[model samples]
Every structure is written in C-alpha cells, then in structure tokens.
Target: MVYHVLNGDALVSGFKATGLSGEIIVARECLIEGDLKGETLPEFLENRARFVEDEFNEARVHYYNNVVPEFEKLLNAEPGSEFNLWFGYDLFCRANMWFVLSLLSHLEGDKEVNVVYPSFRDKHDIWLEFGRATSEQLQEAFDNRINFAGRDFRLAEDLWTAYKQTDLGRLHDLSIFHSPCFPYLPEVCQAHIDRFPYKGKKGRPERVIEDILKKNGRDFKTVFREFSAREGIYGFGDDQVRKIYDKVMKERNP
Candidate 1:
C-alpha cells in the first residue's frame, strides 16, 4: 500500500486532487519550536503535547486527538508499504521530515520511502513556490519522487539524532553530507541553527523582523512583506511572523 505522509493539512486538497490511491497522513505537530527531550517515546509525546498546549494555547485533547493519530499512522504501517513524504525545504518542514525519517529508520520493514519535492518551483522564492502550484504540477512532483539510497537514510538518521539532542554543531557538520535526495538540507540546518537567540539576544529572524518594523514603522503589512522578501528561507507565514512582531513591540514599547 502507498502512504502519503504530508507536512501539514495545507497541502491536502492539492494532493487529493491528484486522484492518487493512497492513505493521506498529515504530520500535525510542529517540532521546530519545542523541547526535544524524553527517555521514551510516550514520554516524548507527552512533553510535546504539553509544549503544544502552552506554545499554541491549545488543549492537550487537541494534541491527543489531532496529533497522535497521524504519527500512529507512521508507526503502524505494514511492512513493504511504500511511503512518499511530501515536505518543503524550509526549516519547519525539514524538522518534521527528520522525525519521520528517524522513526522510519527504526521500523523493521522493506520500506521504500521517497521524498516528493515541489514540482513547479520558483528559483527566487523556492521555499513557497509549491504552495501556489497547480494540482497537475503537484502530481508531476509525485510522479517524479526521489527515492533514497541506504546512505541517505543513514544521513537522515544522524541529522535527526543531532536535532533531537539539540546538537547544533553536529547538525551543521552533518549537513555537509550534501545528500543527493536532499539538496537544501545544508541551508535548512543552518536556518535551524540561526533560529537560536543570536545578536542582541534575539533570533536572527526576530532581529530581522525588529529591524524591518523599526525602519517601516508599526505597519505590520509592510514589515511582513519586507521580512518575507528578505528571509524567505524561514518560510514563516504571517501568523507566525505576527507573533514575533507582537512580542518584539510589546517588549520595545513597554
């Protein structure tokens, strides 16, 4: 059976429009913004569940009902099943991809996993080009999925291990592998590292946002546009960027 593991619900319609006969499983949780510590799998889920509740102001029930089931799909898949992971090249998508690959690495099976990248791409704004792609274009991407060799999975495993351990240095070193299947991995890893608090005790993205706001005044629409144009690699939507803006201004004015 073919299982399509998507990055999020945003790509569901485009994927379903392809008329592909497969189970659509979405990775509902965001791993990029939470603590990555736990001795066991269940404990890890609980920690993430709590983090999601606090960070998103969501309830634990939502995590159990919405998030856990999707991961369960990955865990319970039958042996020899075909898995196609549809994730973007941004840090957010790459984090989830790393987790999925880490899980798949442990699963005992004849797992033939492939990464279905964006088919219709934009060189300038490549991170978001797939979001505006047509359904036919998405299908084209699926049809030309990139299969992983043994070494690719091993590389994914190492990268994920480093991420889980919060080993930024290891992640940077591992990113140098330059896997054929994941050309943007080095940039993604650096983007992840860049997310940590840096200059002026702010994340590089946050610093850029603050600078944009300061230059353009409090007009959020203009600030967001500048941010997107300047740091498209972050792949931050308005809502996410707005959260940062709200916090920065709160601290600045108050």
Candidate 2:
C-alpha cells in the first residue's frame, strides 16, 4: 500500500481531488515548530496536545486522538510499502518533515520514502503552496518526488533532536556541512532562530509588524495579512502572528 502524508488538513481536499487511491494522513501536530519536548514521538505528541488543551480546551480533542493512530502507520511500515511526504518550504512544514524522516530512520522495514516539496519556481508561488495548489499541480509534484537518501535521513535525525531542544546554535553548526539532502535546512533553521526575541533592537519579524502598525496605523488583522504576504518564510498563522503581536505590544508599551 502507498500513503501520501501531508502536513495538515489544508491540502487534503486538494490531494483528494487528484483521485489518488491511498491513505492520506494529515499530520495535525506541528511537532518541532511548537514548544514540545520529549524523548519519544508519543511523549512529544502528548506534551503538545496537553499544551494546546491549556488554551483551546476540547476543540482539539478530535485532533489529539488522531495524532497517534495516524502516526503509528509510519512508525511501523511494512515492506513494499511507500510513504510519500508532501510538505512546504517554510519552518512549519520542514520541521514536520524532519520529524517523519527521523522516525523513518529507526523503522526496521524495507519501506520506500519519498518527498515532494515546492520546486525552485514554486518556492514563492502561491499556487504551489500547501493547500493552495490545484490537483494537477499536486500530481505533478507527486510524479517528480525525490527519494530520501541516507545522508538526508541522518541530517533529519540530527536536526530533529536539535530543533526539539531549541538549540539554534547546533543547527547553525550543522549548516556548515552542506549537502543537497536538505537544501532548505539552513534558511528554515535561521528563520526559526530569528523567531526568538532579539536582545538589541526590536525582534526581527515582530519588528516588521510593529513598524507597519506604528507607521501605517493598520489594524492587527491587516498587519498580519500584509506581513505574511511579505515575509512568507516563517509561515506564521493568524494565531502565531497574534501571539507575536501581543508580545511586541507588551514589550513596547510596558
């Protein structure tokens, strides 16, 4: 059997439109992209779900329930089975992709793993972005998927551990050993590091938002929409953007 694993439910509809016959698992958890720490995947997910429940309450119950069962299939892959990963170029998608790669390295089976990412031309193209692509474009990406090499898996394993620890330095050091395996790793890692509050001057991305709000006097929603369209690398959703805005406002006004 073949499986097309996507980052989230956003792309599931588009993927289904392709009429592909296989299991489509939408990874609901953002794993490394969020503040989750655990020695094992289950522990990590449990912590993340709990973290979400602290804020969202029961709204995430259905999602939390699906995380484990959907993940188990990848954890225990059978021989002759293929797992195709479809993720984007941003920190959110790349971090999740690394998690899957890290897990696959430990699986004791002859499973085939492939990855489909935004091509060079599609890097900034809205059409090829996750949940934005048409069925035909998704099929094109699936048709031209790349096989994960040994180095790619090793890089992912190491990066996954570093990311979980929030060790940006380790990621920076790893960038020295550049390889085609993760051409987008350094940039994404850098984006993740920059998410932290800067010591001097305004924090990078939040600073951008602050400038827009201060200068243009736009509402938070407009600032978020414009900022996302401009930067596009961090892939911050509305909630994340709002969180940053709150932090920036607190620091500035207080």
lDDT at position 24, candidate 2: 84
lDDT (Cα atoms) of all candidates against the true structure: 0.85, 0.75
Over the stretch 15-130, how does candidate 1's per-residue lDDT look in tens digits? 88888889999988677777788878789999998988888799989999998999888889999998999988777778788899888887787989999988568677677736
Task: State the TM-score for model 1.
Answer: 0.93
Model 2 regions more than 4 Å off: 59-63, 120-123, 126-128
Tens digit per residue, CA lDDT, model 2, 1-254: 89888888888888889998888877776653455678766687777777776655745566567776777878766777888998877777777788878777887868788888755344455323555677777788788788887787787888888888888889888766676656666777787777777677555787788887877665787888777876677777887788878877787789
**Clash number for model 1?**
0
Residue pairs with clashing backbones, model 1: none
